[model samples]
Target: MKTRSKIEEEYWEALERLKSGTTKSVDTKSTRFKFTKDAVGREAGRGKGYVRYERYPLLCEAIADAEEARKKNGPATPTANAKLEQQKALKQKAIGDYNQLKQEYDLLMTEYLNVVRRNFELETGLAETKDVKIIRIPNVR
Candidate 1:
């Protein structure tokens, strides 16, 4: 097994402790000091939020990594997964429709060739009405 670095270990630990609770905190700040607030705010619009970069820098680094992973992977909600599934289904349907059209086009091409061959035979006087084999235009199955 690969060993976890101090920052990575702290990140995992924090993630375990926070779970879904980490989203409740905002990252706002004043120019001088550092603090944080609940997502809704008891401090109203003045959300005193910003951790000192020097203090618990490893944990901060870990949190940054977590946030970066979330940004890279995007939303993991049921709605997002459903959208992916829906897109796959649409692509499959489009491919099926294309294959169906290709088969139909091939059948029509075959009928056209049969008609052209009959016309050619008649024009060359190789086949008269009595000698001609009646080839009906085929219906698509």
Candidate 2:
């Protein structure tokens, strides 16, 4: 088992390596940190020849912190900007299509209402006129 102080020191070292881009991944075989079992027993003053399972969680936490810091400090690249512009254009096109469909729907609805009104007048025997006039109907049984 590694001492608490030694584990903390290794954590910091791993974090520094992550920030410096010396290692691309943490808590994996690809990790270049000397705290792993792979680094143990290889060379003197390198590291203990065993995996420190207890320190794994701390190492993972440090890696996550470094990644977050990098994200905040990183600038938006050109590719990211281009993707954003593309998304905006697609949204505009969809809005335009929806508006066109709405206009067509409104026109069709108006025409349908006019047809229904004309049919109702014909069935009721009502004539459109400026003045009212009485019409006599023949009684048929």
Which predicted model would earn the best TM-score?
1
**Candidate 1 local lDDT, 60-98, one digit each (tens):** 565566556645655444578898998999999999999
Cα deviation at 113, candidate 1, in Å, is 0.7
Q: Which ten residues in a row have the lowest lDDT in candidate 1?
A: 33-42
Q: Pick by lDDT: which candidate is best?
A: 2
Per-model TM-score versus the true fold: 0.35, 0.34
Q: 1-141 in candidate 2: lDDT tens per residue?
A: 765567456555655654565653443233233333343222212454333446566555554565566557765445888989989999999999999999999999999999999888875655555365646699999
lDDT of each: 0.53, 0.58
